[model samples]
Target: MGLKIYNTLKREKEDFIPQNPPYVGMYVCGPTVYGNSHLGHARSYTSFDVIYRYLKYCGYKVRYVQNITDVGHLVGDADEGEDKISRQAALEKQEPVEIAYKYELSYFEDMRKLNILPPDISCRATGHIIEIISHVQALIEKGYAYVTDKGNVYFEVKKFASYGKLSGRNLDDTKSGERIDIATDKKAPEDFALWKSADGGHLMKWPSPWGDGYPGWHIECSVMSRKYIGDTLDIHGGGMDNIFPHHECEIAQSEALTEKPFVRYFIHNNMLTVNGSKMGKSLGNFIVLKDLFKKMNPMVLRFYILQSHYRSVLDFSDESMTAAGVGFERLRNSIFALKDVKIAENDDLTAYPELDALKKEFLDAMNDDFNTPIAISVLYEILKHSNNELNKADRDTAKLEAVKRMIFTFTEDILGFNWNMADNTDSGEENNREDKLIEFLIEIRKQYRTEKNFAMSDKIRDTLKDIGITLKDAPQGTTYTIS
Candidate 1:
């Protein structure tokens, strides 16, 4: 079966076919860049990173565009609140651009640590003001938007018959769901802003036909994605929270202007929760990525996320993270164990059905909606088989080589685990031998101490202490740690 993705637009799994064969254009909504990224941001970006990697693995030339929302993301919906960057700038007593730049750099740094590939084009919202204004002008000319007396341009949601198709919300229901005051400038309660006029000397405002104003939150994505990718995107993705107003409004404005489908497939990853509660800064329950990295390896965090299906809700807890670290170490250690195997000169015509089955299972799992959890299970199965083969008294050297290549292909090449332990030529093998020898001597020392041979134990401890390794004794037991 070909790749099957669960499209939020159809609310079902659909076969993925790019608009142009072998060339896929995917746009995922990126961070607003007003503050440090949180775990939720990690989940969304890492999920798409896998998608991007797998697409290339399947021989598709994919151009992934993730926008940086440096401006135009308001505090509240319907464009009646201050921009997020503006609020952060006010509190920090700096320009909004300064805040955006600071957090944008931090975001990429965190993503790089997590092994998330940078997008092909990261278009900033503020950098595309001219394109956004032109987009709004096209909407106005098509009779789908109106300019208010205050120089605010609002998209007439009622004018677009299919405004709620992507979100599956009708106009009446959307209007009734609004519990806050509606902007008087909007033509209707469901109408959203295409542009909002600056009340005073707004720091992020730009010159548009409507006056000194800025593009609306939803308009920013529509303009940037279309300009960077195309009028029609092969895939549009983000967290599920953007389903209703943010993505819905993007579809309405873009389709109304082009009279064509804006996105072929819409992918939304589920949110991350902490202790069964949704993670958000407003909730005071979010864990910043940088702070979390202090206590955890970034790859362990990525492994924890991929343990569950992308569409499934993942909960964060100390126990879960610890278990993930252990599991990730096991996975990595299994790969490292195979690095010492020497390839036999004779090619193995030996048909290993187990190896073939493992590869098939992995491909099947990934083909079914990029089910990474199942794919990881297959990795463990392959590792288990490799361990059993390695422990045999007489091993087939050629079979071992095949297993080694298979593990490398699945884990490092396909799954994005760098696992460069084999690449460190001088230290990698030497350290392995040293670690084993140290553990052996430590075990011998333990036996001596158990029999009350204090002199031998002390001699062993002092000899090791002369080197870099240090021995620590605790309530559990005596263990050796590298200094």
Candidate 2:
């Protein structure tokens, strides 16, 4: 089956077609880099990473561009607050540039831990000020934007006939939904800022055509996406949270200036919540990846995120994470166990009907809108059959080798797991130390199981799995393998 993706703009799954065949230009809204990267950041990036990976796997030479919002990202959606990085700088008593660079490094570090591929061009908003000014000027010339007496520039929502086309909210609906006070300088309450006039003491101001000001949040994406990719992008992706105002504004200003569609397929990943509630620092449920990495492997978190479809809401909890850890360990252990199997030196899958069916199922799942959960289920099924085959006294080395190749292709290539980190068999001393550590953990788990404290026992098992140790509970006793 051909690949299909759910285009948010179309509001349906559409056939994957690039404007330029065999070449895809993809853009994803990146972090504002005002703080540490959190679980929300992980979910969004990982979702797009799979898209980027799968497109390449399907023979598309993809140029993925992700922007770092280092400036002009106001804290308020109404575009009426201090810049996010500037606010963070004030809180930390540092320069705004310092805050942006520190957190930009943090964001990339966390993304690397999750095995997310870096974008082809990582553009920062500060670096693209010249381009942003040029784009805003074009919008003004086209009568889609207006410069106010206050030196602020706003996109004239009413002037753009299809302002709400992407968001499905008309001007009336947008005006009624304003929780934050609308900026009085705007021609209409719904009109958004293209550039905001910076105050005299503002730390991140640039000399634009409209006096000394900075580019607004929406303009940066529209500007940078066009500068790197083109007026039209094959795939534009972000969290669903970006759909309404941020993405909607991007469509308005971009189409207004270029007179072309902003994106072919607008893909949005669903938001992640913690224990059924929205994750937030105010609620004390915010999960920063660097802090979470202290407790578990980042790959386990990636596996957990992939367990649910990207369009489905992912509820985060310690319990759910532990469950995913166990499943991840089982999957990795099964795949890693075949590392020593000798191949038949013949790459023929026709004889292995079961492996062939499993391969088709895996590809079918991935092709069906990158359905990772279903794809992961196929991995489990492959491992189950492989385990049954291994139990036999005479195993087919060729069949086992074929299974290994299929599993590796899916898990390592498409799913983006670091098998080397999971199955690191270093030298003698390190291996000896890891072996003893596994034995120690196993013994503790056994005691907890004896005491009927299944929760504690399960915790021990899951914790060990998070660190690349897989324990097997057999009828005789519990034995462990270092993944």
Candidate 3:
């Protein structure tokens, strides 16, 4: 079956097809760079990273553009609030640009620690003021937006027929949900500002048609994506929380100007929750990514997210991370075990049913809209068969090599889990052997201590500790994690 995705715009699972055959353009709304990124931010980016990686794995030449909102994002997402970056700047006693730089670097560092590749181009709103003004002017010319008496610009949502199609919201009923105070300046209750006039203390003002002010948060994505990726794109993605005023306003302003479909596929990731409550900073329940890195490597956090589908809600908890740690260890350890086994080489091999079956299943799973959970399950299934084979103590070289290549290609290359324990240099082999030997020594030491042979146990641990191998015995078992 061909790949299919549940598009938020259509509200159905549609067949996947790029506007252009091999060249695909994807736009993901990036962090605002006002503060430290949290787990919800990680989920949105990592989910899109999966989509980006899998599309390239399928031989699509993809240009992924994720924008950085350095200005005009509000303190509260009510569409009428103080600029978030400016607020952060004031709190930190720094220029807005300084705050943007610090958080933007932190964001990329966290993403790298989590193995998320940076986008092909990261366009920031502050950098693209000219382009944003141009787009906003186009919207004004098209009559979809107009300049307010206070030098602010507002998009006329009622002028666009398909304003709420992406979010499936009724215009009349949107006052309570995702709505700000419909100020007297706006044409209607659903209307959102395309540009906010600069007050006297505003730090990040630009030269727009409407005097000196910053571009609206919604206009940033609309203008930057269009300038970088043309009038339309293959995919656009963000959190489900942005389905209304943010993305909806973007739609109205962009389509009104270009008269082309703004995006082919709209992808929205469900929120990451803590104890069944949304994990949002505004809600006072959020875990910063940097703090998470202090506890566990960010890759563990990424792995935890992948255990559940992107479209499904993932609850944040210690138990979930602990479980994900086990899954990651098992998955990587199995790859390591595969490399350690001895297998024969084969040239003319048309008779390996087990090996062929495993490869086919993995490819099939990954091809189906990048169903990574199923692909990971296939990894376990392959490992199960290989483990049974290993138990026989006679390695099938062809099968071993095939499975090794398959896992490395999908897990290491595509998923970015290099599984470095599967290396093949002499030093690497020696290191692996020493690791196993040290593990055996630790186990034997535990047994000796159990029998009250304290002297021998002490001697063994001392020798290992001197050689850079330390042991920690936990309630679960006596094992070693690299320092």
Please tell me which predicted candidate would have the highest TM-score against the true structure: 2
What overall lDDT goes with each candidate model?
A: 0.87, 0.88, 0.80
Q: Residue-wise lDDT of candidate 2 within 1-483, one digit each (tens)? A: 999999888789999999998989999999999999999999999999988998888999999999999988877766787778888999999999999999999899899978899999999999989988999998898888899999999999898888777778888999896647678788888888999998646788889888999988999999999999999999999999899899999999899888899999999999999999999999999999877876677788889999999999999999999899889889878987888878666646558887889889999999999999999999999988778778899887777877888888899889998887565322234545667778887888889898999999999888888988789999988898665
Regions of candidate 2 where Cα sits further than 4 Å from its true position = 345-350, 424-483
Q: What is the lDDT of candidate 1?
A: 0.87
Task: Tell me how many clashing residue pairs each candidate has.
Answer: 0, 0, 1
Pairs with backbone N, CA or C atoms under 3 Å apart (clashes), candidate 1:
none
Query: TM-score for all predictions?
Result: 0.86, 0.87, 0.84
- Model 3, residue 337: distance off in Å is 1.4
lDDT (tens digit, per residue) of candidate 3 on 241-308: 88876888788888888899999999899888997897766787789987666556555676678777
Residue 217's lDDT in candidate 3: 80
Worst 10 residues of 1 by lDDT: 421-430
Query: What's the lDDT for candidate 2?
Result: 0.88
lDDT of 2 at 328: 85
Looking at candidate 3, the ten consecutive residues that score lowest on lDDT are 420-429
- Model 3's alpha-carbon lDDT is 0.80
After aligning candidate 3 to the native by TM-score, how far in Å is the CA of 124 from where it should be?
0.4
